[model samples]
Target: MGSRRHTWVRRLGAAWLAAAAVVGTAASSAAASAPTPTKSTAGPTPAELKRVDAHAEKQRERLRLPGMALAVVKDDEVVHRRTWGKDGDGKPITRQTPFLVGSLSKPITSTAVMRLAEAGSLRLDAPVRRYLPWFRPSGPSADRITLRNLLNQTSGLSERDGIAHADRFDNAPGGVERTARGLAGARTGAPPGERHEYSNANYMLLGAVVEKVTGQPFGDYLRKSVLRPFGMDGTLVDERDAERRELAPGHRYFFGHPKRFDPPYDASGVPYGYVGADIDDLSRFAVAHLGHGDAAARAVVSPAGLRELHKGTVPAGTSHRYGLGWRDDSFEGERVVWHGGATPGYHGTVVLAPERGLAVVVQDNAYSPQRDELLNATALGAMRILLGGRPAAASTDPMLDAMLTTVTVTAAVLALALLWSLFRIFRPSRGRPRGRRRIVVGAAVSVTGLLVLAVTAVYVLPRQVTVDLSEILLFVPDTGWLLVAIGVLATALAVTRGGLAVRACLAAPPLARTDPDAVRDRRQEARAGV
Candidate 1:
């Protein structure tokens, strides 16, 4: 009986082991057949790119931008080129239309400098004074500044000294010297090489140095050395050349509508902010950034030099580093080097992700207070398209729409109040005839309003940008003119109200001034029918 039980146990054990083995095999096969996740390293799909178009269109509408042009380069080749607005004359903008690229000129200027260095004519670490003997930094202990300092914005120079933000040097050639001398008076903005304070004056000196050393007009040097070599024929370094090239007009907002301006005349800040190029020429510019230049591109600057141009030299912000002229950053785990530009009537941005083999350039023919973020918004959207991500949101605009709305509403209210003051001046008041106290209050308010506008225009704005009444009138017509008009109207109101208050005080009722007893006798006499 015991032997029979043992045999049964052995048979049961064998069955269980066979069943377990079968189940394990089935599980392994199921796992092998299940889907496995793989990382995506592909360019945008056709549908995805089409979606980017709609996305860009939406932004243009939401921002009320007049027009825009964009180009995308992938794998060192132009993959997409598009335009989405009309020129100031209502002509349709094409990829060939030129727009002023403001400070986007910096990187191109830096590229030229890098090439000069490779040619052994310039040194990145040399003192700026080594090239231009007239450049004298005021601080005795802070006399040291290099070409790298200027490119990285660590030159300890301020945008002030009445040069960078001022109207473009209306004069040329000869004027470049006079304007550069003015920079000699510039105070140190920071300890040299300590921190970054973006100053167009830094690049101004760079351009001057380039011209001095090259013995050529800075514009001519750029045209021959960089633009010509890269086959960017349509690009113009001089504003005087803009009209001959058939460039697009810059538009600024007036009463929330686009207003075109005549071309600007200044050239003092050209190296820092002004270069006119169409999307096609700009692509050639972008191609050079990828370090895959053809023989022609390589001839302008060696690939090694190009890489050096992008190598980070200092921290720009938390995640960004300022290279020679390019700004380095990591976006979504990928390296990106980019730059942005703003001018009176135009705004633009150019971005490059060398590791991903992509570049994007965007230009807009519109300017508004909110445009600083708007141009950035448009550029990042294009980057999203190239990187297989959806362009969903915009950059954080601190005060464009909000400040505009507030200013508009305040202007409307003030205008209406001024009209009411006019009515008060002519029409008599009821009851107590509004005491002198009311006029005093009105005058106080008018004076305060005028003072605020004046302080902001003269003291605050010039600190941020070199601006005068005339330029403000053209660039920010709606906001700037409203402040002026309101101030003038308020001044008039104050004078009128103050004069009325004094007259009212002098003309107080004579009867009320009489003695109380005399007033009682006159009332009694009237009741007696005298």
Candidate 2:
């Protein structure tokens, strides 16, 4: 009997193993037979591309963005380029539309500096005092400050003096001089070239240095040497006096209103030279940089100079670094040189992966309010396409990821608890009597609370701000306080509503009764219901 049992057990084990192997083979076969998604040559697949398009549209809608244009370049060719959103009059934005590239102006400035350097008209190591004898930073350090130092943003100067947020451009007499002198007189935050500090003042001073060296305004010098040479005829230098008929007005989000800024002059009397022109010209500029200084019938800088611009100068924290006006980030073992542009109302990003020969340009009218995760992902996605690799779904958004995880966990817990509460509340009872009055009161209270929160948030709070799109763009400063006050009101509404629901439940009939006779009635109803 023992021998027979052992033989039977062996046979059963063999049969189980054979069955498991067969199941495994079948599963593997099914997986292999499953249709794998093919990468689209035109762009991302319909669903993926739709998500990106929809996301851009939503941002435009929420931020009241007037227009947005994007161009993706692969292997030095513009593979896919599209424009979405609208102009001031609701006209569709096109490839030729010009949006202020904002701080993107720095790289262009840097290019001009390179040309000057190559011509021996300026030296990177030479101090600014060589040209602008009147230009001075604090004392000894000012004399030591070099063109390279300014480009690298290690000039030991705050980018700007304490300019009030409401006061955008300096309106004082000789505002540019006063602003420059104020920055020059400001105390140093670190020893010269000790560490990297992004100072707009550095670039501003560099602009002045260009003017001083070239015997013309910075704008004229940039036009003659950079823009004119490259045939980037659409690029504008003096945006202060831009033709209103041809210009795309910049817009900002105020409460719920999308407010545009009036033209004819920027806050600085210097013609908004620090940030100018739109996306297409910017990409042309990037193409020149990524293509080693020659692209689109323009040779803005020499190949060697372009290399210098991309050469890492100092460690940008731990993972990346800065080079001239460019940034160096390691993406999937490939070196990516990129830059971002931002002003009060608009945000722009230019990403280039030279090794992979990919470039992406993004310009958004809305300030992300968080570190720009979407912009980074877009760039990374473009880079992955250049590498012929699929972009993994892992999120690089720090704040968004945290918020999403918190929301998901909170939602799960709430859902489980809600289901549990409903299950218990609706459970069949043996003989308890129904309480229609309690249910009616609960429903009415809940409805009333929701209506009140909605009314306060949508109608009352927004009314306080007076979201007039027309007047604010005329450079009116009073709108700032209105927006702030309204945001506070909105926050108050959210907090009040969140707490009101729980508070309303406090008036709900008690599950336990104080009177002993009530318990008997409850028991009778429970029995009957059961």
Candidate 3:
């Protein structure tokens, strides 16, 4: 009986082994037929790129800008480039179209400073007095000024020092120097380190320092030290060169109308604004911000110097910190460095997400009060898309729209009021509403309008914008002059009507009629203000 049981067990074990062989053969065949998986690649996803392009196009259309260019950089290369609309003259915009990337000039200017420092020609912490013996601000802390402070905009020089026009760039005696020297008695914010104050004059001053240190014109020094090394040959340092490029027309946003303006040569503004470049050339700049690798590695500045250029030195007015030439912010805890610019007819931005190895540059040929916002929106939106996030909605401040509406309505209302005042003065007074208070009110409004106009349109506004009334007209056109005209006209109307109202008030109570009830009736009418 035991032998018979052993034989049955051996037979069952053989059957199990045969079934295992069949399963293994089938598994091997399936594995051989399946395809192998490849590695995930770097750069923005296709969906993300499409979304960025759509957003750029949407903004271009919505704003009706003359032209626009966009480029994205990832892992040391531009993975995408795009252009939209046409030149102001209806020329098709190409990637080579130059945009006057205003004040975005600061980063390149600051980069040159860093290179100078790396070459032992300058020091970041040294007093401005060390390099620019001529920089004399009215502030008590003037000697406390440093090169770093100027680059980070904490030197506290006010916009009042921004040279009002580009002629300062000319060869006139003390032309640009005169503009820089104007900062000697210029006002400053808090002492250098106390707070952040954004001023173009700070950089304009640095441009002088660069000129002194390099013994070259600011543009020539920058071209040799920074642009040439970075292979940014397409970058034009001269504002005149910008005019010669396939440059697009610039437009001014006036109320709701677009008024085209001749682009000016802002020579004194070169250090802080007025540099122009194509999207392709600017992609090299975006790549340079990536640090330590790739095509931009050929630039003269050491990696350490490049890193220093990005350090947050002070609080930027926005949600970022102002570094050398870069504005520093964070995206979902990752580092974001960027700058934006708007000149007479252009708005542009360049952004870098170092951790993600991504950057974006956008430029358009249109000027508006909200131009900075338009560029910033595209930059931040591009960052979001590159970081695998849905682009945030464009941030147009409703208050700006409301203010523009108010300007239009107030202008219309002022016109009507002026007309009514004239009617009251010229029309029959025998049978009509008559009151000294009405005329007084009209006079008071006129006086108030005059005071408001003097304070705002003449004094405070020009100081705030660092441009005179004429410059304002050149940039914004029509709107400013119209406002000034209304103010002048309103003041005249008020004076004339107010005099008549006073004369009516003082006139001998309509002669009292010489009747017994005449005195009483006149007194009653005077008391009742009839």
Candidate 1 lDDT (Cα, 0 to 1): 0.67
- In candidate 1 the C-alpha lDDT for residue 21 amounts to 40
Off by over 4 Å in 3: 1-41, 163-175, 292-297, 432-457, 460-479, 495-530
Cα TM-score of candidate 1 = 0.81
CA lDDT of each prediction against the hidden true structure: 0.67, 0.53, 0.66
Evaluate model 3: give its TM-score: 0.81
In every candidate, how many clashes are there? 2, 17, 2
* Model 2, span 1-530: residue lDDT tens: 00001121222224323432442243200111111112123433445444445555554454455677767655435656767777654577777666566566677778889888988889998876676676655644557777898888777764223221112454434444444544555556666787776656676667667776787766667777887566566776554435532665555544335566544434242322334556667676766766522443335576678778876678654566777887777666567777776544455778776644567787755432222444344445555545455443533234333422332343344345445544545453344443445544554554444344334323433333332222222222223233233334334433443343344345444646634688898889999995
Error of 2 at 400 (Å): 12
TM-score of 2: 0.61
Candidate 2 deviant stretches above 4 angstroms: 1-66, 139-142, 159-179, 255-258, 267-274, 292-298, 368-377, 388-530
Native-to-model Cα distance after best TM-score fit, residue 287 in candidate 1, in Å: 0.5
- Candidate 2 or 3, higher lDDT? 3
